[model samples]
Target: MKQSDIFRDNADNCLQLAERAEGKPAYKRYSRMADAWTALATEQDWLDGEIPPVKVRVLQMQDT
Candidate 1:
């Protein structure tokens, strides 16, 4: 959950960067970050019930 939240936060930032790139060299990198965030989310789902609550707490910090 922590990983997912961090990934989600970073993905949001990367998407913003990608939007600004709009024809620049960094576009691909930002796009890839967004994809990585998706992969993280999928992996978290596959993790089933093993995730730690501390991790989730950490992820929540990203929003603050």
Candidate 2:
């Protein structure tokens, strides 16, 4: 299994754990862990050329 696969599994596990958690703190922690894992997966995908580089656009706010 690849590193990205591991990260994806871990993220899924974290989400499940979060759902089972009762307290806000525990749930939040698990959710954050899941997010971190997902980020790692995204990085791996980028490195593998599976995903294109994200383009950032700055939108100007106009006052009406």
Candidate 3:
């Protein structure tokens, strides 16, 4: 599936979860996640191109 589609799906799932949440905290968490996903999808649609890949570094713990 496309990235945009995935984001939209995630948002829908979040909203559904929010609706079924038992408390304010859980509901808010899901709602926020849905908002985040929706925003990402909107931004992706505006970009209309492939999103750039992010670079990451793996941090290794020092042996004590």
Best-performing candidate as measured by lDDT: 2
Q: After superposing candidate 3, which stretches have Cα over 4 Å from the reference?
A: 49-64
For model 2, give the RMSD to the true fold: 4.8
Question: Could you give me the TM-score of model 2 versus the true structure?
Answer: 0.78
Q: Sort all candidates by lDDT, best to worst.
A: 2, 3, 1
lDDT of 3 by residue, 1-64 (tens): 7788899999999999999999999999999999999999978876865655457999999999
lDDT of model 3 at position 37: 100
lDDT of 3: 0.91
Q: Put down candidate 2 lDDT per residue, 1-64, tens digits, no spaces.
A: 8888999999999999999999999999999999999999999989988889999999999999
Estimate the TM-score of every prediction. Answer: 0.58, 0.78, 0.71
lDDT (Cα, tens digit) per residue for candidate 1, span 1-52: 4767777888888899999995867899899989998778657755755554
Model 3: per-residue Cα lDDT at residue 57: 92
Model 3, position 30: C-alpha lDDT score: 100
User: Which one wins by TM-score: 1 or 3?
Assistant: 3
Residue pairs in collision within model 1: none
Q: Arrange candidates, best TM-score first.
A: 2, 3, 1
Q: CA shift at 11, candidate 3, in angstroms?
A: 0.2
